[model samples]
Target chain A: MSEGTVSGAALRILAAGPGVTIQDAGRHGLLRFGVTGAGPMDPLAFALANKVAQVPDGSAALEISMGGVELEAVDAAITLAIAGGNFRVTLDGQAMPSAARLTLEPGSKLSIKAGEEGAWCYLAPCGRIDIPAQLGSLSTHTRSGIGGLQGRALAAGDVLPLAEPKVLPGGAMEIEAPVLKRPGDVIRVLLGPQDDYFNDAEIAAFLNGPWTVSVRSDRMAYFLDGTPLTHAGGFNIVSDGIAHGGIQVPGEGFPVVLMGDRQPTGGYPKIATIIGVDLGRMAQLRPGSVFRFASVSLEEAVAARRAEAAEVVSGWALAPLVRTSLSSEFLLGCRLVDGWVDALAED
Target chain B: MSKPLIEGAIYDAPRFLNSGETALVVEFGRSVEPEISDRVLSLDAAMTALKLPGVRETVPTYRSLMIHYDPLVIDRATLIAQVEEIASRPGTAGGPASRWVLPCCYDPEYGEDVGEIARMTGLSEEKVVSLHSGATFRVYMYGFAPGFCYLGGLPPELAVSRRTRPRPPHPPNMTLIGGGLAIVTTFSMPTGWWLMGRTPERMFSPQREKAFLVAVGDELKFEPVDRDTFLSLDARAAAGEVVARREALS
Candidate 1:
């Protein structure tokens, strides 16, 4: 349908889980004013969702946490894609893969439930989110109550205005969801500006030992629970600006990895920093998930980041979803021309 | 030209701390002082002037400048080499930038810590207000919260430890002091710093043309106003008017 044919464009939330908020690439160049550029926890997944939805590279999307969301199209049919955590997704009543591109007709309900793996999920629509950009971004910094919908988490009865999707939905398509974590996969980190504060024994213990993601984690930072690390020197440092994934060890001796919504500066001594490409992987590790930090050289970290960027530019491989209900009704409903290619056909 | 002057190069040699693949912290010194702050601001200004590709943003702190960049566009070594070259130049840290006379209301209602502070410092409540308002302060940096201004130059007599227990969330624009730093909070947040008063002028406003009112290295002087005046100015400021008076410092 064309833009005018659809009724008022909006998405009405019937139910929402915690930490659900609108996000874009992030607000940049304002950190000097103490504003944090809060964005999606999983940047790669966010980008993939936008790509699958056929939206512009950095269009705003809903960042749903472990607890999922249930919403309905309000007077407009909209095309969308879900990515990130392997969530259980249902469009109207048909169960679909977590990372699938589909359309929600007017009054159709889309439900995303927490599944077997991952923590953060992305729900991207193929249109500009009709929200006023605060300080040049739609990314929500909930701690400061700035940006997004009233600078807070999305809740039931919230109506988000949506613009007409630039590209129309062609057919149901699916892609492999981002692999947030795998068994034995170590999160890589770079040793710090304040590594000297920790003794050799402490450093070894930190790098060699396992640390569980604490339940106290949020968008700001993830607190690690393990043998509390003591400092060889003072716990506090001269306050300095913090970078995303900077691992600050506080007086309490716990390592807090600052994230997308972290404050601009901090006084705690940072012992290590997670490399850029691995930050998303680290963010997706849910509470109680066990992981170890593996130290990587500066050169290696940069190379890894470059490799990921190249992959993003090359684009993801999309596949057609095949339903296998071998009944007469299911056979009759299948679109013969849609995504139907002979197995032996050559390009 | 005489070899480019190295102004505010407090450190004999700066230290480059790699935060990750995406950022580098050029620390000028180990202490918080005007010279160190000057070095941070000067390097920040130089980085801005150069407009180096891949440099996304630069945050100036008390003794270091954190430069965030896109690693793909510019590698760490190249970025550091360029920054080091700029730091080697003479007179990089320019002089004073601006001065502001911000209106504050120290009426007991807003200045909740006035009595407690006066008792601790062995000064009268009026004396405390005068000492705080009369002193000139410098904008060292912004941190901890959005638009929160961390100012230096608190009078020694007025210096006090942070609250033993953090108070409940206070409203935005509340003037606060802890240790040697004076702050004007941009949003309501629980704080251990003593609330000295409240200001009508918005230190950081997303609605205003400039989101942050003052920049690093600027001078600030608090002009105490009556409660009624504070309410009147607060309303206008809320409506997006720049109520705080400012002037360029020559």
Candidate 2:
């Protein structure tokens, strides 16, 4: 009810994957009440998707996992931006780039399928989503089932109503696929609030790890598989508050990096925390991919985060999409159709 | 790997652990106790009162306070200094927490693990129920799941290690015990604990004015009820009534 004005635009999920859910900047101030902030897995990618759609920052958007989703514009034409992960997409039989923006004519189908890289994708519309906020967030924490699309994943036939758009006039646009620095690069970490619990050898094993991302990974935590870590001090710690990217090593010794939807508090000792700038890289890692961790100073982590924040707000990544078939000069000169195009017209 | 400067002063004073670049954990102690919980909650209240710029949210747990803030708006050193000063100040009393008397039914049908628990603890079923219901429990904090109330002060006799194999999804609203801790589940979840009884009182209801029924520092005592009375209360609670009764403990 606290959402904005409805312009009657809507989108219906024709098909969806298990992990698909609506997410925003995530619920805040409720962590004390045992609520986790279930924001997008890759905050950088999520923010970029919203920027591409010209929606306000942190607008509610669909988080598509590897299984992908099929949707259709129902009531009226709506502009959408797809970002994060290299997902195969087609708008009504026309193949589109993995990360692209397009106006879906009413009744038109849009399909996004699994791509070769990345584990999560985002689909954002250029309007406010009509779903009511729970505890001041649209981010769906599926474990608790409290926010977004009835606090659950979207299923086939679920309709998403939209409010009036901020900027509706734009043609199809696409961006280059996101590139990773390296296949097995070092992810920076800050050693623990509980590092003392582990002896120097265990800490060395953690930092020197070429750990594999477990198949059991989800929004809650990414379970790493490698040499099991034994606690020097006992496994249990007094249950304490956990933050996103806190790497908690249980008695099993395999570290579990807490994600966006991690529980507010945990009983296991946290060995280290992944730096903010590296979290997106960690999130995009496909299951079975190998990675390592390197320790960094607090100053370095802060500096990296501040720089990344500036880049996100700078609109540096966004550029007008140019179709390969049409020359940039030709496409810029021509005035694309602003309103609905006749389906029967010849190209 | 070289430790951060923050870790150097940790041993000398309160342990302030960095949680990534955005959050810091102000640990008051190494174990769970009323004094530690008191310090954590009081600091949480005092910090919230300050309305410090860039402080996004704070999670006050059993032994530590984790403050989530925007590093872009507030630097780490300044935030840590403010917390240390507030923590050192004397005589910050927490508001009186509410004491709740929630109705629970320990019938073998509803409390599926009651017989097993009695066998494990070397006590009769009636004695197990009496011992559990007799103790006055304190709410340490809510975590692991939404509105899942983690209660402290379970009787030593009732305490047992968590099941080696966690059971598949158990029904919600059960008063469960394990690993020296007690919890009233708000939703159906796979728990490694022993289910002692079922409660008609909902610990969490999204539709309710207050979604979370209990708060940290609140005192709770379970009142035994018969199967028929539990059924009636369950029906009433499902219809949106707050079946649990409470009064401020001044």
Q: Which model scores highest in TM-score? A: 2
Candidate 2 lDDT over residue span A1-347, tens digit each: 11233367788999998999999988989888888889999887788888778788999999999878999877677778888777898877667778887777676789998888888889999888888999899999988888988789999999998888433443666654343222436889999878988888988999998899999999999999998988876788778988889999988789999998999899898999998888878898989999889999999998988777766666344345433486666654443323213332446
Model 1 lDDT at residue A339: 31
Error of 2 at A68 (Å): 0.6
What is the TM-score of candidate 1?
A: 0.91
TM-scores, in order shown?
A: 0.91, 0.92
Per-residue lDDT of model 1, residues A37-151, tens digit only: 8988889889888877777898999999887899988777777788877789987656777888776766668899878868888999877789899888999989988889989
Model 1 chain A worst lDDT run, 10 consecutive residues: A336-345
- Model 1 C-alpha lDDT per residue in residues B122-211, reported as the tens digit of each score: 999999999999988999999988889998888999889888788999988999998767898878999989999999988887777787
Candidate 1 clashes between residue pairs 3 or more apart in a chain or in different chains: B4-B90, B5-B90, B5-B91, B6-B90, B6-B91, B7-B91
